[model samples]
Target: MLFVTRSLPSPIWLNGLEALKVTGSKGKGSTSAMIAAILRQLGISTGLYTSPHLLKANERIRIGDRLISDGEMDASLEWMLALRDSYESRHSNDNFGAFEVLTGAALYHFFNQRPETIVCEAGIGGRYDSTRVIPGRITALTSVELEHTELLGNSAELIAYDKADLCPDGGTLVAGKLEDALLPRLRAYCALRSITFVEAAAEISELKYNSAMMQFKMSCAGIDYGTIETGLVGKHQARNAAVAIQAVWHWLQCSKREVEEQRFTRAVREAFKAVRWPGRFERIAEDPETIIDVGHTQLSLHAVAETVREMNSAKPIMLVTGVSYDKNVRGILDELLPIATEVICTRAYHKGSPVETVAALCEAIRRGIVWKSADTIEEAMDLAVSRAREQNMTVLVAGGLFLATEAFVHLSGGDPRLLQFF
Candidate 1:
């Protein structure tokens, strides 16, 4: 509907508020960050907005790598509350969900700042996600994964349909190897919508990431090409970079006349290393080389499992995991169980599935492992972490990001600033 609700007194009209929306199951945060960083390097004022802030609510809004100030957040939130009241009064519709409110604030901030480009990350699904309200030049899918099954659907193809629904008349879709199950549906959607679809080429040969900064040189199929050296961890990250870089490169050719080739490559790489995303397989603490990946969906799980194998020579591992009620407990447990030596299951304390189902699934499929639960996440993770870090082991806090978020804060000694406390 209206990204800027009538009641919302949409941010003051501005000039050159170009937008790019990044939507998909995984890597949306990193992809959006990469795009924004690239645009910023090109000497353009860029605004980057992502959701459910891993570090702080402010992380959801940024003009560049710099976050919006507390004073700015307060002002924006106030404006949004007023808009919510008016929206309820006039149409009696809650167009702005909790996420929508933050998104609107970001748009307002960007609009006011008049950035040359704005890269927006969708909150949930693509079609009706709060961020979809804004018009974007190009739509990029990091990689589709089945998430929010109750809200999206049961199958991977169904999830693709929801995400594909966002490609409007003139917009183009940049994708990195759509999952086999979702390919047919995505093609049908693209054909029906009469939109251009570009499948970004992945260097499948680069099995395991080597070198602190390895150069990935691949040409996008049927599109102008560029290579990027991404420091972001995991093999999946290279694909994410390719998808984002292709989107930026394609968007450049579409919107502008002819641009210098050097400028294009430099823009994409100038802020390469400075783009920081905290909890995507981040090594928060290294005493035991314990890594934290807030990967929830199946695609993300596979990435985490693969990264673990890469790090420890495919060693068997112990995992501390919890998931939201909306995820497929069986699918998640199945994907991870093969790589797991022990699975300590816990519930996110959220409304989705119960911890009992997760625990039950593990015992049935996994051999020689104790399935345990905790009344609270703390108790569950406390037991899980204590067990995993003994020796020659890596403890993975996966499932829900909230599980990783909570563990991070608690392990750092109940630091309230973990939210902003770090």
Candidate 2:
């Protein structure tokens, strides 16, 4: 359905957001949730708005770790429903779509509660995403990669421009370290707009113990905020944390010099643990140590493969996988196959993929990888785990989120916990 946001009145709830943060890229959902969790620990009422809910649509909007009450959601829905005609008329009978309606609903919830902060995940490309309409007191970009090419753009430069679109006047703009190709465009854009630019890489050094997280003091506007550890899996997470920490402290100056380095560090540590962003390389079941990652791009896949190898478990690794029509599956497999002991390909379109074609491709690329295919996600998962059981091996389930995650939950008795975070 058409869920229009612009035609609707700006809710009074928008006024309460002392700090507004937006997370971009594949990790947007997890990163945004983590930001909210940290603010909540400091006893600030925080609202979160994310998209493409896994199991239920209600999961899209949350306040302080809980889904909004049904009554509140329904009331908001009714209001949007009533305002539909006016929005359509304004757009020459065109109305807001699904994303806009939910975003408006979330602002309605957060603003009325007058939460200490709001953490938002950009649904599509940054520039045109419904969330961009909100004036972010602080904006953070996750590592941008090629995504939604038809809607956003085909090149990294185009995508970067789309991401930089969220940099409204007077808003502090934080960018995930731009890829070599996108960096020049992003920098130029920031200069043209006079947006306060914060690059994730310039801060924290990677922590020695876990190559995964980085510990660094965030210095903004001559203020130094103390260090905190990020538990996000990839080396990229260190970058994501840098963007988040900077944004948090940047907004801190909005009121009091209340948070110094020490307190800020402490709050971030608690926030990292409290943030239970799921699916991105999560070892949800450790007995067989099953892994689920939603790494759809070549860069993301490379990151996942590197981390799995770093885990250094003696257990021989077996991979369960899937992908999209546009994804570089052959290229991703080039990075993924070296570490895997065997490969099981599953058709995963949700609607499904061509199982045999996927299997054939896997076999051709890695001649002796024991490549095989299954008719459905469940069957493919069963085959992978069953083989792992026989070999006492480890299973890393990944491909597209639609393929690996759905399969992992189905074989694990279809648990609801899978959707709660990832």
Candidate 3:
């Protein structure tokens, strides 16, 4: 069944594609993936839709932990293109963008596959996000921060509204640890809408984490999910998982499904232990300990810094970093420079910030921070890894998610077509 919106193709395709939508400037992808993983472990057929795929576009849409196959994705795209052409032919002076078409295509494909549940991560803000068409039963807002100011607004409160507004009226809303200033607005929004609001941070206690795993206990709606362990490292992931656990529980409650406490606990533990959200603090190699994280913003990179600090490794930390052209290069560099023993600035093959531009910025702020510039990401990775091995230091390759894609390809010996935009 092809769902169609009156004015656009997306809203129509989203009909019956109900999901738990998660939105934020950061952590939403990980949070959504965690929710899907837990549900899948429960023997539920689950669909997870996330954004900015590191390798392939199909990676953005998954069924039961497997990405949509190339053949199926192609078929879905063909169907969507037909609808797009029909819409354009009938209505002049209007055309859909890539995301709008892709959203419709994803929903259409999911309709055919008919997963028992879906967890979708919104692209950009919520109210107008293409994924918003899903008519979500549960909404999750991860930490709100300043981002996409031109289109989203200039303040944190506005961004929070765009995200929090995704929560369905009279449905469930689970949130991560938000800024103090954002809480009042969110609380008022939930209260006005009669949303059953739960704070993920508040429900979590006895939190403990290491480089390899994070452990925590979450009490959701007075239901204590005993000690949960997630393979995802860093303190931020614990918070993300907490939000996912609460959101999934609330969604289950909405579905009126019978909940077996022991079974639920077991499923959650097993899922977290095996759940893998690639490019988020992913360890690519053992020698010199190479790591890659798709942390583009300062708020996101802070977690990376904190994780490195907590490690207290005897080895030094070397960084290979770059950013998208649209990102705040200086801000990201500021957060990274102090944490690195040495830095190699480079540009990804895509429409990244100019290599010379990043090199110049790094040079200006060097002070005592030894740094170098590379013409390409490969050169930078090679140099960083070589130096790291020689010095017995850990290598962190980070920046935009695109950089993560490149690093993953280079380190894993994956196909080059994985780098192509879908």
Candidate 4:
């Protein structure tokens, strides 16, 4: 089960690469970004590698907040692809996919850059995620759930066990809250592996949020930080911040780096203010107050709905949603349909569940609620804006990351790749 094949000079590719692997069904991206931000603020050069880029492949790799340059990407991809071709020539049975190639390239970039720290987010369930190939010093799990049932497992505890497998032997594992049923499984796994398990949520309290920012206090890992403020919205984000703080603190300890109290506190404050992970409760418009959230899961959608309700009291909320075919559409709609003034369902400018199917699903769960179907996301946005102006409602573009990414590009008028010119 080697990721970097021996045919590709594995020693040069893997040696001296230490990482913090964060994996779960949700919040992995934001949590990794938060850790990278805090590390950078503490004056450590950091490399962050995430997945499912919104616009460009280069978005998956970064060094100190700068995406890998096109020149660097070209060079790395060329080298990796050549290695893949050579390896396949000899061993046809084993091959690499696009994600594997990209993951290797990101690791190469990080190794070359020699960042003091690297934060890697798993593309899927963590037991065998490509990011696990890195010599991770600390592992962080961000609220696991029953996802990737075919690959991970069918139950919550099974899924937790799969993610728990990512914790390196003798390495520290930090995690947020989990289902009560999964705790025993996690405890058993950690005890078997002799991994240090720290529950981050236990140290989190007084999580309060407004439209602009969330405020919370965290006292964890022999480091007590009071009244932390983050620009990331929602109560879940506060928990995520706590997880990031604990994970990074553990990394600091393992690396034997001293954290000056005043400087570290200031770094936490500045990191939250500067942290910018897009497509989660993002505001795209001002007049009608259009917002976008990539919360396809029921729990995440519930949090999004709660945040939107608290933010918009004067105006009714209209939902423009497009979800993937593989998602639990009924579960998500069941949580969100009742909160919207009207629902406009459509497909993003990418491959997904057809807009017609999504519309029908919405209709079944509408329960006399107002709803309509649009052929494309553009048309859906148009209809939503027109209706919002007519009815004095706010527009919430949600349900899937593809839809949210499309909305971000469309609203910003920044990327031509998302423009579907059919």
lDDT of each: 0.71, 0.69, 0.80, 0.80
lDDT of 2 at 135: 54
After TM-score superposition, what is the CA distance of residue 227 in candidate 3 from its true location, in Å?
3.6
Stretches > 4 Å off in candidate 4? 1-14, 202-211, 221-224, 310-312, 414-422
Give lDDT tens digits, candidate 3, residues 1-422. Answer: 12344433344434554578999889988898889988988888888888878777898888986789999899888988988998889778977778888787787678778787788888888877877767668998888889998878899988887777777678777888888777877888788989877887646677676566777777665666788787787878877877888888888888777879888878878988889888898888888799899888888988888877766677788888888898988888877777888888888887679877877777777765646788777777788878888889889987777776787787776643347764
Minimal lDDT window, size 10, model 3:
1-10
Q: Could you give the C-alpha RMSD of every candidate to the true structure, in order shown?
A: 3.5, 3.8, 2.9, 2.6
Q: Judging by TM-score, tell me the better candidate of 1 and 4.
A: 4
Candidate 2: where are CA atoms >4 Å away? 1-11, 89-93, 202-231, 255-257, 349-351, 415-422
* Candidate 1 structure quality by residue, lDDT tens digits, 251-313: 777668365876776666666656667788776665444567777777888887776676554
Clashes per candidate (backbone, < 3 Å) = 4, 6, 4, 0
Those runs of model 1 whose alpha carbons end farther than 4 Å from true positions after fitting are 1-16, 93-95, 153-155, 180-185, 207-217, 221-229, 312-316, 349-356, 371-375, 380-389, 415-422
Q: What is the Cα-based TM-score of model 2?
A: 0.86
Best by TM-score: 4
Give candidate 2's error at residue 286 in angstroms.
2.6
